[model samples]
Target: MIRLGGGPLERIVAVGAHCDDLAIGAGGTLLTACRARPGLRVDALVLSGGGGEREQEERAALAAFCPDAELRLTVLKLPDGRVPAYWEEAKTAVEELRGRTEPDLVLAPRTEDAHQDHRCLARLMPSAFRDHLLLGYEIVKWDGDLGRPTAYQPLSPGIAEEKVRLLQEHYPSQRHRPWYDREAFLGLARIRGIECHARYAEAFHVTKLTLNLGD
Candidate 1:
């Protein structure tokens, strides 16, 4: 495998359609990033589930997931599973985030996601963040929409365990869900790790990226 790494690695913008989306999809990557750089700045935006317990869970969950980073999160009040209806609000939120931070990276939902809200958010991301690197994170759910990701973030055994622990501990509401179990979470990570030759890993679909190779 050809190892490559270069980017500001300082600021990041993480967007999701719902409360636990970010954690379930890219929590390991976020853990890896923040652990390497203690004070990384993360600006998180979600299109739905604000002004409620779900929003509360998001705030606490992200804080735990981000670790030492300076995290700022926005949970919009747009109804869940109906993001298309509030198209303007979703677009405006991403644009506003773009205007505020020149993020070195944007962690967002993949366009191929089976969920309508996720698809809408993915479609809106590129329009707002025209000249930035964006990694489309995947969420394992009943939709069975997982695809072959183009990129991988390898995680250590310890990091992988921590991610699962934090996810389970932080999101109390999600515990009742059938798929939200240790086996399901770790199983996917283990599979991704096999693909990347690591003990555990997270996969992503990078739609656009600028490479800087040097001598």
Candidate 2:
């Protein structure tokens, strides 16, 4: 398998349609990235679950995921599962974020995600950040929307384990949900890791990327 590396990333913006979406989809990658680049600037945005306990949960969760990095997170008050209804609001928020930071990477929900909110926010990405690398992250769901991700971020054994631990530790409210368990999280990572020839990994779908061969 060929390897593609993103060299010396300074800033990353992670957007999600709902609370826990970023952690579920790209938590391991964030952990790995933060460890690799101390003081890496991370700007996170969530479209829903704001002004509630979920928002507090997300803020703490991201801090754990992106340990020691310059993390700035914004949780919007848009209603959950109704992102498309608030298209203008979501678009404006995304565009405003883009205006503030020109990031090297963006971790977001894939356009083909089964959830309407996820897809709604995903569609807004390309229009907002035209020149950046946005790796569309995946969240395995009851809808069976997990598709073949075009990109992979291989995770180490320790990092993969920590991702699961942090998830279980931070989101107490999600614990009652049947799918929110260690096996489910590990099971998906194990599968994605197989695809990338690693013990564990986080997978992503990327619609566009500019490969630079010249230094």
Clashing pairs counted in every model: 0, 0
- Pairs in steric clash, model 1: none
Clashes of 2: 0
lDDT of 2 by residue, 1-215 (tens): 67988876999999999889999999999999999889999999999999999999999999999998999999999998889999999999999999989998999999999999999999999999999899999998899988888999999999999999999998998999989999999999999999989999999998988889998
List where candidate 1 sits over 4 angstroms from the true fold.
none
For residues 1-215, could you state the per-residue lDDT of candidate 1 as single tens digits? 65667556999999999999999999999989998999999999998889999999899889988889999999999998899999999999989988889888889999999999999999999988888889999999998999999889999999889889988988898899999999998999999999989889999998778777654
Estimate TM-scores for all models: 0.97, 0.98
How does model 1 score by TM-score?
0.97
lDDT of 1: 0.91
